[model samples]
Target: MASVVNNVVAAVANASNDEAVCGICLDALDRKRSVTLKPCNHQFHRTCALQWAESVRPDIDRPCCLCRSSVREMVGRNGRRVVRSYPFEEEELDMKRQVLEGLLNEGDSFLISLNNTRDQIRKMLKESEIERAIAEKQRQPDEYVVDIDQEGAKLEKRKHAIDNLLEYGATITALGDAATVACAISRELEALNRSNSDLASEEEDGHYAAEQSHNEDTDSDSDSGSEEEIR
Candidate 1:
């Protein structure tokens, strides 16, 4: 499957307002960056979609938050293919399996980094709020007032950073989900091919055994006829 997060992000960046409401974030689709999944046609705010995708486990298919359809394909309103996946040949499947493995690993690493960044941001925010509280309790000196304002600004920035990191985490999680599905499909196809091969081999062996038995029987009959004729 295609990179789920990237496709959703592209659709969001390019989308215009619609009358639909996002089921994930419960926000008006007309008020936010939105995407309508193909086939299912379920609309969601892009950020909300990302958050939902991030919450899904990477070992399974990422489904639509509303209808639970596997999020494999998506197209934009402009008829542009946002994300489309196709069945792969055996060789291509092997390659995709390998690539997805690497992608999952990288995605995991990126998510860990995002989590660390978020934690740091929250820590800074908390520390700033505490400092601001202390400043408020003291006399309203000019320097203290400046300090409070600066702390407020820092808190705002930290909160923004945390929000941004959360978005990034969602993107990474979506990518991981896409990779997981692709890998699972690749493995299943490979297993099916192997099973078919085994069945063919067994049928060939059975035919060969029948032919050998028939030949042995024919030889025995000929020998019996010769002995009877000589007697």
Candidate 2:
């Protein structure tokens, strides 16, 4: 059994990609830089693969970073190789579970930040238009031009962050090697669904906040009228 495991591991060591890049680190794979973490024949940067194997959560299969395949060792029992993950796989799996939770939290945080920025832009649009209308009636210069510039800057920053995120997603989707990407692709489809849900939630929250603010403003106006009548 030991000999069989050694042989398989040895075979995996020789697997190399011809100028192909490691999907995780985006580094070129060659004899020096690449290694195939076996049971799944995918080549990655030695460091990248180690980091990937290290990243697997406790409950899920120890996945090859590129393919999400179980990178288990075939243990020989009675001269027959049986699939049983290595000891590290168990540890890695636990660690991976933590990371999965962290990723979900991070995604929610990102959506919150995105929604806040969208709300700011919405508010700014209303303020700018109303201010411009008031200025035109009085034949006065629009004093909020600087505010508009600041809002434009904010919009540009938001756009750049979104663009980079989209490009990263595109790169992940463009990984065409079926043996190394199919499983990951399915997870990405699920991510797309989560993204849609996030957007819907953002829209609902925005509408609710707007309504609350409008009601508060109406109450403030009524209180001011009552004070004037008292005076």
Candidate 3:
């Protein structure tokens, strides 16, 4: 085991000290035209790596062929490279949060508008009621017989207006109720998505832990076998 580790270390040291061939093109690496990737320290021709990076879709980072290390920067169409610097998941999460916040704000505004409309409807009904009462109280018995038709017409018109107002108010109230329910359902769905995501992450972590434990146990058994052979 020690010899294997030493051999791996020596290989890495030699690669770092000497100029190695480009992994992609399998040709000699030029000192000025080569790039050493981070973390992996694998060397490759700058042009060859750039071409490889550009061949893959730009939406995802490219991984090194030799060590599978992530290459966060890619050569753009205009030959400019930009660093991602942040995780894609984090960016998506931020966008979702912004959208949810906007939805909540719009919901608040809608509710406020509905409340104002209801208040205006109530105020109009109260004013109309008070006017009707005063007009009736001011009428004399002689005037009542003469203006009965006119009064009836006015009352009918007023009643129609009141009925229309009530209908409009009811429609608006129903819409508001529906909107409230929809908002609640959306909230529940968002929570369910989050719960499912968390569960999946937990399962993945448990699987990784189990795999690592198994690997360690296998290594231990191998070491025991070597010790017995030496004895």
Candidate 4:
């Protein structure tokens, strides 16, 4: 842990004044007193980083505040490696913190879209009577039709939403929350598709039955007329 903090020297002190601001403290390095995390370069105030690292005590693999990666070494502008040589190996520091500051907060923007999808699916299945579509087709078998435009819109929305979720899950640094959300949304989409397929199949069957019935009636009438003519 000390070695990680010791690596917090100003690697780019000459670059710009803004470059010297510590991510945690959000302030400039006090009197060239800075450190940079490595083997990749990121500078912070020595005390700011040491305090942050020290807070992680027993967990040496604590993530840096700037980028959620575990901290290992910090370096100075002069490229000198720093280490805690003092007797202070594990000085205890206590502070209550939210777990990684809720590394993917619950109220994330992504969740809003997920919730909307869920609601839409629920309303379609529970509120909207899909069976009506089948009934309508049965009543007018010759002109059996569903709103193709509406169906296409629903399909497009589901595809776009699911695609976004899968892509986001793939690219995210942390996949736990993202994967869970994606799976839940995917399941909802599957339910919607199944509902639509069943509705469409029923409608087709109704149309076929109506067509057969109409054909049978027409044949019976034609036979009656022929028998009268023969008499």
Candidate 5:
């Protein structure tokens, strides 16, 4: 009977030793690795603590394992400050922590890509606006040049018409001056012809009076000689 009692005590000691070891590899804790203890005084590898918590749960409402104090405190790097009756399992806690870290990293990368895309679109829009303004500025000079050329053409035509009118007026004035000179010469010649005609009529009337006086003197001398013969 004493031998049987000794075997039972040895079995209990071995079980106690196994409980103190890490749950994942069932290995003894080295000095380099830290051990996490639950509220139940159960110890495990720090890496295996989270895994145990997720696997041995009653439901999602009970997020922690029976060994952990509470769900919120179970996954933290440091153990819970206030100890409770129940706690999280080692395996469940490790898996939960890894999943959370992966999601956080993915979210950070997505935000960075979104910001870069927005910046590229804004730069493209600004460049397009600048190009449109430059094109409009370039067209403005061409429109102005066309307007100036049209105005110059109108001014040149008006100048040509004015020159033609001036030349025609000078030619008409010269013709009028020649006509006035010819009229003056014709009036002077008519006055000289009237004076010559009056002089010729006066000379012919004086010669006719001298011939009648000579004929009357000859008749008187013949009568006087006949009276003297009768006596």
Candidate 6:
């Protein structure tokens, strides 16, 4: 009896290992217990399917699986069709991808804008620093102060500093605008990162299947272009 049981277990294991199924759909069990079996005999990777279900239906009262007619019927008892509750479709995924790409482009543009603004701010700061240094030099009771044109020189320097202060104020306003844009871009990038991570955890092939790599490359190119604009 023990030998018979061992043979049966081996056969089941072999069948599971040889099984071919879509990792995304989780239709067939590729390995024994790779996915837990429902009481209804429907199978899914325990973690993968549960996360997918949660995303589709946050309420636990909703049907547990979308792959079976029985599960649909169960959900229908509560006056909700399972299909209506889980509205994830291929078009929706495409929409999400497009949204992510848009966000990435926006981020890159904002970063470039901020960099330009920062450069202007640095130039203004440097001019201010130079003016301060020259003012200190004039205050020193040196022989240069006795020069006939020293007073005029000092007045010129003072006027230049005043003009630069006005320019600095304008630059500061530009910097503020850039900062606000950068903050918005940061939030968008963070959201995209979260979505990418969530998609990644679905399965080993989830990123590839979703074309995430291709999207990332496109985003990178956009970012590089922004960097070039900054330069």
**How close is every model to the real structure, measured as TM-score?**
0.28, 0.24, 0.26, 0.29, 0.21, 0.19
lDDT per residue (tens digit) for residues 163-226 in model 6:
4333323322233344654454455445546666777686333332222234444333222223
Model 2 error, position 161 (Å): 38
For model 4 the TM-score comes to 0.29
**How would you encode candidate 5's per-residue C-alpha lDDT over 63-111 as one tens digit per residue?**
3232224544432223423212122122322322322232234533433
Off by over 4 Å in 5: 1-20, 35-37, 56-231
Q: Supply every candidate's count of residue pairs whose N, Cα or C atoms clash at under 3 angstroms.
A: 0, 7, 0, 11, 25, 0
Native-to-model Cα distance after best TM-score fit, residue 225 in candidate 2, in Å: 88
Tens-place lDDT per residue, model 2, 1-231, is 656544444444544535565555544453223455567766654444544554655467676654556776322212232221222223322333333343344533544454454455455446546644554675553333443344345545544444444344334333444333445544644554454465667743222101113343433322222334554
* Top candidate when judged by lDDT against the true structure: 1
In candidate 2, stretches whose alpha carbon ends up further than 4 angstroms from where it belongs are 1-16, 58-60, 73-231
Give the per-residue lDDT of model 4 (tens digit) for 111-204.
4555465455444433224533543555633211233223334545544554444343333323235565445434434544554565667744
Ranking by lDDT: 1, 3, 4, 2, 6, 5
Off by over 4 Å in 1: 1-18, 76-231
Residue-level error in angstroms, candidate 1, position 123: 31
Per-residue lDDT for 80-101 in model 1, tens only?
A: 4432111112343243333335
Local accuracy by lDDT, each model:
0.49, 0.44, 0.46, 0.45, 0.37, 0.39
**Lowest-lDDT window of 10 residues in candidate 1?**
205-214
Q: Give candidate 1's error at residue 46 in angstroms.
A: 1.0
